[model samples]
Target: MRLDKYLKVSRLIKRRTLAKQIADKGRIEVNDRTAKSATEVKVGDQITIHYGDRTVRIKVLALNLIAKKNEAQDLYQRLD
Candidate 1:
């Protein structure tokens, strides 16, 4: 799945547009390498997002194109 879509579907960023913007700005990484909005996200991949002074790291556990509010958290495992 696309990184931006994964973020939104997983409720990481709340919106696909915001996730795309952030990814395009080089603020997101996959497996420690810079990732683009269209980057492919696979199960078990680690995603690190830089949110200004704060950083969030998570491991992708599943990919769901449409997920319920409570199911969003099941898509990724927070690492930090």
Candidate 2:
């Protein structure tokens, strides 16, 4: 799935446009490299998102086109 879409569907960024903007500005990284909004996200891929002075890292556990709010957390696993 596209990185932006994955972020939204997984409830990471809350909105697709915001995710796209974040990705475009290089706030998002895949496997330690800067990632764009259209970047393909696959299972087991590590994703790091920069948020001000803090960073959030996660590993893609699954990809789904749509997911319920209750199930969104299943899409990725938080990393140290």
Candidate 3:
């Protein structure tokens, strides 16, 4: 799944467009490397998102095209 899409589907960013904007600013990373909005996300990949003075880290657990609110948290495991 695309990084941006995964973020939205997982409810991490709340919206796909916001995910793209954040990625475009170079505020996101995958597996320790800076990632673009279109970067491919795979299971077990570590993702870091920088937001203001805070940062969120998570590992990809699964990928789904559509995730229900209750299932969004299951798509990724928080690492921080």
Kindly provide the TM-score of model 3 when superposed on the true structure, using C-alpha atoms.
0.98
Worst 10 residues of 1 by lDDT: 61-70
Model 1, residue 43: C-alpha shift (Å): 0.2
Candidate 2, residue 2: lDDT:
97
Query: Measured by TM-score, how close is model 2 to the native structure?
Result: 0.98
- Model 3's lDDT to the true fold? 0.98
- What's the lDDT for all of these models? 0.98, 0.97, 0.98
List, residue by residue over 1-80, the lDDT tens digit for candidate 3: 99999999999999999999999999999999999999999999999999999999999999999999999999999999
The digit string of per-residue lDDT tens for model 2 on 55-77 reads 99999999999999999999999
In order, how many clashes per candidate? 0, 0, 0
How far out, in Å, is residue 64 in model 3? 0.3
**Is candidate 2 or 3 superior in TM-score?**
3
